[model samples]
Target: MEPPVNTIKLSQTAKDQLLKLRRHTKIDQWNILCRWGFCRSLAEASIPSPVPIPADSNVELTWKVFGGEMSDILILALKQRCHNDKLGTDKETLAHQFRLHLHRGIGYLAGDPNIKKIEDLIAIATKK
Candidate 1:
């Protein structure tokens, strides 16, 4: 039997951030959350679980978005991109940054050994 689909929980702030990312990148929130969970588990060796959503006592819908590993990866990617002026603004840089994480994140979710070596591939891919 398939496991129950856990409702993703997000704090109002995190939810807003997630929605903003989704709006700018045109990526679905659900997909991004799944990717975030993968990146968190693989990069940080911690299992991420959603906290009880706040709307009602009985409904456990929203999850608090903590666990900094994925965010750390994102920050690094943005730093690297911006250090070289690869993207002109923080908005564009962040979008591309999320794309990079998505690539690595998918690899992690799929159990690909290549996930562990993404930086090398990225280096080659980005080389002129």
Candidate 2:
């Protein structure tokens, strides 16, 4: 399958929220945090809320930067998720969902009440 596009951009509000998550998580790299966000959203039992975030920020990441060593795996996961959601698996649809899931995951990480520190992320991960 074709890898996801590198045109993924975040909204200003998303950048701000991510910055907040950075401060809380103490993880400096945006791409790393973004990977966490992507997985978090994908792991959710339901579809993300339909709120369309504006692509206003200058921050940009290639597929390599976003997924690092797991780029291909991430693409596969996204494709599988698209199929599960009954969405088209075309490049365009994948690109759109890449944006949606990333933002929704960012929102999830930043919005969670229990994640006050880096250790909190581990707590959530191990939670039953």
Candidate 3:
């Protein structure tokens, strides 16, 4: 069935979580990719293996452990995988991974104790 038109509506709690996620994503992107040390480590670690790699492995684990940008490393891995015609996987894997990251990030933000009363404040902050 088609989705509802009013689906754009979100509870204040959800809105706050999203705002936090966006900020977190942006920070991670900059601090990890823009930093010389982190960027070099990530690029060095992103090289494909001599043998075939699995489709769903934590592509950024090595780089992440080395202070590389986790998000950037993951994106590069996914893009490489997506471009390989020999791989049997489809775009569904990419979509699912994106959704999983979003869910985890939002949950993390919601569970932060420092964000008390964030549920109500989120909507106000997110309205643009």
Candidate 4:
């Protein structure tokens, strides 16, 4: 399946947050951290607010790089989320929601006081 967007551009704030996350987790890859953030947002019960997010940062990645080996599955998850939210699954809607969710999730992860290390991140995923 084609991705919602060919390229993902993060806001400058998001880039800074990811940098903090990198320092805390010792993870060097932006894509890996972004994947975690995207999934984290998806797990939330509430939909992300459709606020404007400026792509003011130099941090960018292709969809392939962002989703890595799970590109297809990630796209499916985004589509499913849109469906679940009673939103259209058209390209525009998918792209919009993807950005919202990605940013929201990154904020969520970065703000969590518990997330001081990679194990903390794992704990979030493992918790019942």
Candidate 5:
């Protein structure tokens, strides 16, 4: 079965931010960079405001390319987040929240000053 989020089209800003993140972290793969961004956004406690991410650029990826072997696990976690945030458990809501979190996470990684290297990401994870 195909993942609920079959394709991801990032905003122009998000694409630019992801490029910067790639340059800094030395992670060239878009899927890997996006995984970091998505998880980073989810790690935050606040609900992301619903904003439209215009697919202004050519950046797009299949869900398998994005989630890879962890697609099922990521789907489950996204569904749980939807339930927790009262965003409804329907497929549409889950997809919307997934996009929101992915964009926000990319922003988090792009905006963070402390994440100069891969080790900083690990440090942030271990910090209490």
Candidate 6:
């Protein structure tokens, strides 16, 4: 399946947040942290606000790089989430929503005071 976006360009703010997350969690790959952020936003009940996020950072990841082996599943999840939100699954909509969720999740993760290590990330995943 084709990804919603070929290249995911992060905002300057997102780059900063990811840098902070890297320092705390010791996760070196941007793609891995971005995947976590995307899924984290997906887990939320509300839709991310459609704010403009400038692609001002140097960080860029191909869809394949970002999703790794789970590219198809991630696309499916994104499509399903769009459907659940009553948003059409067009390329534009998917791309827009993807950015929104990714940025929001990064912000959420970076802002959380409890995320001090990789174990904290696991703890979040295991939490009910």
Considering summed lDDT, which 10 consecutive residues are worst modelled in model 1?
58-67
| Cα lDDT, model 3, residue 125 | 37
Q: Which model is ahead, 5 or 6, in terms of TM-score?
A: 6
5-109 in candidate 6: lDDT tens per residue? 999999999999999999999999999999999999999999999999999999999999999999999999999999999999999999999999999999999
Please provide, for model 2 over 1-128, each residue's C-alpha lDDT reduced to its tens digit, 9 standing for 90 to 100. Answer: 46778657899977988999898989999998899889989999787766778989988887778888898899999999999999989998888888889998998999998777889888877778
Residue 3 in candidate 1, Cα distance off native in Å: 4.7
Model 4 poorest ten-residue lDDT run: 43-52
TM-score of each: 0.29, 0.92, 0.29, 0.99, 0.94, 0.99
What RMSD does model 4 have? 0.4
lDDT of 5 by residue, 50-127 (tens): 988787878999999999988888888787778788779677888889999999999988999998888887787788
Candidate 3 matches the true fold with a TM-score of 0.29
Report lDDT per candidate. 0.39, 0.87, 0.36, 0.98, 0.86, 0.97
Of the pair 2 and 5, which is ahead by TM-score? Answer: 5
lDDT of 4 by residue, 40-80 (tens): 99999998998999999999999999998999999999999
| Candidate with maximal lDDT | 4
Question: Across residues 1-128, which tens digit of lDDT does each residue of candidate 3 receive?
Answer: 11111112223443454456446444343222222222222233233223322234222223233223354555555445435524323455543433333233344444555544434335433546
User: For candidate 3, which ten residues in a row score worst on lDDT?
Assistant: 1-10
Q: What is the lDDT of residue 1 in candidate 5?
A: 40
Candidate 1 lDDT over 53-121, as tens digits, reads: 232222123222221344455445445544554445355544443334433443343343333333533
